[model samples]
Target chain A: MSTVAGSHFWGPVFALWQRDMIRFLRQKNRIIGALGAPLVFWVLIGSGVGPGFRLPGWPADMTYLAYFFPGTVVLILLFTAVFSTISVIEDRREGFLQGVLVAPVAPEAIVLGKLLGGTTLAVGQALLFCLAAPLAGVPLDAAVLARLLPALFVVGFALTGLGFLVAWPLESTQVFPAIMNVLIMPLWLLSGALFPAAADSWMRYAVAVNPVAYGTAAVRRAFYGDGASMGLVPGYGPALAVSVVFAAVMFALSVWMVRRRRGTV
Target chain B: MTVYPVETDRLRRVFGARVALDDVSFAVREGEVFGLLGPNGGGKTTLFRILSTMLAPSGGAARICSHDVEREAPAVRSCLGVVFQSPSLDPHLTVAENLRYGGNLYGLRGAPLEARMRETAEALRVADRWSERVKTLSGGLQRRVEIAKSLLPRPRVLLMDEPSTGLDPVARVDLWSIIGQLRAESAMTVVLTTHLMDEAARCDRAAILHQGKLLACDTPEALCGMIGADVLTLTGREPDRLAGRVQAEFGWAASVHDGAVRVEVPRAHEQVARIVEAFPGEILAVTAGRPTLEDVFVRLTGERLGEPFFEKAGGRRKRR
Candidate 1:
């Protein structure tokens, strides 16, 4: 077992992850599709929704575009995560995932490599979407970008891990799109992506419980200073703690599922 | 020199309520082409999956070069290569890129990786089309590239699941030639699963499996010998009635199944001539043939190989 562990733990993981990156790079259309849709949403939706939308605790003068920029970033990350998860089904159907499963690599590495590869792609999309924030009238600062980097990484990692966990039990590709549809919208809405968490007491409670809500809130705080707080609900310290915990839990579950499914191919 | 490159003992696998493989066992001597011959859904792929370390056995164990498939899978994997029944190459990548990526997976890099890629491509006759995208390559060429990718690591055992499924006759011959060369030159143990009779005939030894059971395992000649005679197939307008009449009149051992009458006779050619002469109106076609892997499979399973099962909704037999 140790010999098996040593031989496969790193080599195939790195190789598969690198291959995935290369695949993403080669498909320029997919990158554009992932980044472009969210940019359009941020611009069109933010502008359209900006005039009438105002949160209770948010500064009265804050424009809808500035208020929603952080949410859009989170939305972009969520979209990328969901899409990347759905691609696992495609990979499985294409036989590449099966090839990896049959290789000497450890199951943990398969899960980790897939998550890392997917997280990298998701983060790339998020960063590209972030580039549009300035032009959309959202303020940009070096500190915000620097602070959001680790938060985005954490969120991407968490989402990728969650994606793998969802993908493991699925037997057919047909179920993935439907599952994503059921999952993505609820997770997005409940995460306070469209409105501030402090708007409603119940919503603040719900956001506190939602894993994605913590990630979005953390990202929003990074972007707009303390103005993005959840009021008396929970501080950034607890939210960061919850996000990290959620990531760890999801990652552990994903790894376990991969190991269980490893040789049953 | 008396090494068994691949070995398994009572290997079994269960999926849900179905027993996919049951107490399967075999060994492949170095430099020999070992064939797992079974009908579709007969546990051939399941066996290959376990041997390739893609599936864990529910019972028993297997080893490649003395490394346990379950415990020492990485070491076992390093010493083996597999061509899955499904196309395993990345369709988006160029053939050269796919091969290079495979090489990289096994830790080959720099000059050695490049040299190995060139050698494999040339040997597999895919060198000229190395730069073409895999999706653009013909099915046969894609299979060759897959085989080449497997050969890159110089593995001790090469496990292929139905490797000749989509190849044309000429391509099949080419692939067989490559297998022969690989076995002869590299002394690698080549294990492949195929339901195709001719392909099974090419193997040094073959195992016939049915419904997750290993019915028989031996040299192709020995398997044919077990049936004791050549096969005489008679297709007639009324095959069932004719088969019964022929059986009653000549006291010949025969069976009517799959729209054909199968007779085992000492000299099938002479018997076929006599049957054709006697039953002129009834017989549409009379052909004498040697006992093939299909015959061996039928004899073992009590069912015709590749016959469509009418029992279930998704019962269509997959082609090899």
Candidate 2:
């Protein structure tokens, strides 16, 4: 099965990780665009729709701005971390990835490298959005931010893994915009990030099914504890559990996609 | 036993009903440049993929430096360096950054990696271009840097898949010169795949593959010697018709290949004038020369190596 033979694993992984970081840093426009669009959405939508956008069975005191803050964090994670995986398609097109495919390292090393790199970027951007937590009426502090870090990281990791899964076998990113619409956009929109999953609707089933819903719910729980529609998606403990499982499964699928053993790709 | 740098034992691969490779067996000796000479879809790519560990053979086995390409793939990969037809360098990264990452993947680091990169770049005549981004380098220069990057780990065998695919004539010449220099400077074995007959001639030994079958494998000189006669190629607008007429009139067997009629005969230079005169303006030009690797491949397969793939497919469909 081509299990990693030696200490050779980490070197290649680190090389890939460092290269992604370099690319992320070099493209300053990407930083502005990825973070800026989400921030603008949160400000415009949360401010314009304030107080009137309450679903049945929600906390009465929760304002739209506070309710959508974690959603904005997840949105930034989706754009910064998940979209960064499009580089895999670019790598294949540029012929850079074919070199790595033939390298001595196992394919798991590649999955880990890409996952860690994307997760780091996404989580970093999400954490930056945490500076706006006080605007959402959530008490922002060191302890709460600490809780937010791990949840944000787990959710970001899962999202990046999802990106890797899609990008692994693709030769070109020509259809990625279509995929962003059909797949990524739906995942976020239906994740109860915009609306409570616990409310009676046909999409509640979809929210219950989507792993990202639990991820969003977990992040929201970290933001406001038990008050912000905690039972709407699966509460904090069950939501975090699903997010962990989701991340693991996504990573496994990505590794299997490129492993030389089965040679399926 | 002297372990050959590359070896395949009855190697076979199949995609559904079509066998891409069939019972191919050969061993490339150490310190010599070996070539897998074949046309596109002639199983050269399938074989290259198997050896490079990008794909697995459905049956039989292949090895690199005595390690099984399938079972010991990681070990095999560690000792093997590969140059693909595509550029592996990141266009945004400078030549030096690319080399650094390339070496890091092989677990080479620090001063040793720097020394190796400089030494290999110097050997490849690309030492001065270290700071240039790969996208800024000419196609020829990028190929040199690609080779330099592969050599940083000092792999025992360097394998290339159609390394000259997109090069211009001058770049092709430059590539061969770099290959020759690499051979001269080190005992490392080099193996490359090529469909070009002239490129095959530059190899120490060439293996001719046609339609998933290994026709022959030997030194280029010895392969040419298999067809020990002068070859005359007659260019004309209608090679199929010309080949038929040459056989009907001259009573000498002639075949059509790549828009030319080819004939093998003793004293071909003398016969060329008589044939051209007999055909009168029908024959546009005639060139007589010693049999090349192309002639050897033609002799072994009875079909031209450069025949369009659709022609073979059409033949198959007709038979079906």
Candidate 3:
């Protein structure tokens, strides 16, 4: 059964994670692409709609950029997570992943390695995007940063795990971008990242069920502070608990998916 | 206890309706360079995949160092190092980093892991290329790095699939020399598949497979001896006609292979002159030499190894 065998479990996991980081560092275009799209979205869409767009609970003083700010951070994390996890398909095709598969390491370690790798890249990019918060008119305090960092980690881990689950069984990368469009974009859109869920009464239920909604709310609460107590966004306590549970569930699902399709793929 | 590094009893693998491997049993000793000589689709890869724990057998048992390949795959994997026919290196990483990652999978770290990696790189003569990315290295150097990666774990049995494929003649020779050195120094048991007869001739023992069946298994000398003492090759413009004439005139059974008339004889040197004389100007060239592994393969399979079997099947399928 090779039940991880103590300290050895971390070796391959850490090595694989390190490989992903090295590859990410060498490819500057990937960093630019992952962070650029959401930045463009925050600017173009936030300006296109104009600052006059407002919800009932939002501060009358708020601008569209401030409302779209936290959503852009989540988008950065999601896009980076998706981009990094897609390498699982590439690695399998390139034959490097096969080398790892045939090794004595457990499949759980392989999944953990991939999850950690993708999550780290996503969180790093998300943090970098958060540096532009002052431009969006959101105050960047130490307490807010502390809360935002862990929220980003939980959100990034869950999204990366989701990407891992999708990429593990896939042999080719041709259709993955379509999945990103159909599944990921919709999940992000319905999470109340771009607008208030109360704008559409039925969407509140959808937001309640959407796992990404909790992540979006968690980030929004970190940014909005006392003003985030409105009904539109879930409270920080419930949001963090849900995001943590979602991350844990996705992690387990990623491990299960890898174990189910280990040698077959 | 001296356990056989590999043992399979009637190991069977079926890919849907196609039986890739049928009831085949074999055993490999602790230390010897064994060759699995077969044409493509002859089930050599299926067996190799099973032994490497990449594929499970449909029926029967396969063990490595007495560990069940299916039930105890981790134990089997721990002791088995595999060099796939296709390149398995990450072209993005340097040779040293690749080796370090491979070692990490086996719980190898710290100074001991670094020392072992250095030793393997030195042994394979790839120490100088350690800092170079695998994409920058030549095919031969990449192959040596692959071997070094496998050696990092100090496995008892090394399984390679068509290890010499895509290598030049010089690289092939270099690879065989390393295999020989590994055998002499560490007594490492090597099992590799090769369609090249010259490569098979270097093995301590070789198993010939045809149509998913074991045709013959023995040392190179013994296998050649099964056919005859010598082989007479007659090259002519009309090899089929020359083969017919030789059969009728000399009463020797001659076969046409690869556009050449071939005949097995006890004393080929004495018959070479007679064949040229009998055929006159029809024979462009005549050569008599000791039987090679190719001749032995031809004797068993009645077809050359590595040649496309599909072409032959295409013709048959049209007629049907």
Can you write out model 3's per-residue Cα lDDT over A1-265, one digit (the tens) per residue?
A: 2363222468889999999998888778999899999989999998898856766766777788888898899999999998899999889877787678678887778888988999999999998888889887888889899889889999999999989888888889999989999998999999888887784689989998999999998998888774554566878778989999999999889877766555422
On DockQ, the candidate that comes out on top is 2
The i-RMS of every model, in angstroms, reads 3.5, 3.8, 3.7
TM-score of chain A by itself in each prediction: 0.89, 0.92, 0.94
> What is the C-alpha lDDT profile of model 2 across B1-320, one tens digit per residue?
87788999999999899998999999999899999998777888899889988888899999998888888888888898999887799988889989999988888888988998888888888989989889999988899889988888888999998899789999999999989988998999999999889999999999998889998999999999998789999998888988999999888789877788999988899997799888887888899999999898788877676646536645422200
Q: Against the true structure, what is each candidate's TM-score?
A: 0.91, 0.92, 0.94
- Which regions of candidate 1 fall more than 4 Å away from where they truly are? A1-6, A49-57, A135-137, A171-173, A226-238, B1-3, B268-285, B307-314, B317-320
Checking candidate 2 for backbone clashes, the offending pairs are none
Worst 10 residues of 1 chain B by lDDT: B311-320
Shift in Å, residue B259, candidate 3:
1.7
- Per residue, candidate 1 scores C-alpha lDDT tens digits across B42-80 of 898888888888778899988889878888877888788
Model 3 segments more than 4 A misplaced:
A1-7, A199-202, A225-227, B308-320
Which residue pairs does candidate 3 place in steric collision? none
Which tens-of-lDDT digit does each residue in A226-251 have in candidate 1?
64534543455566678888888988
Q: What would the DockQ be for model 2?
A: 0.51
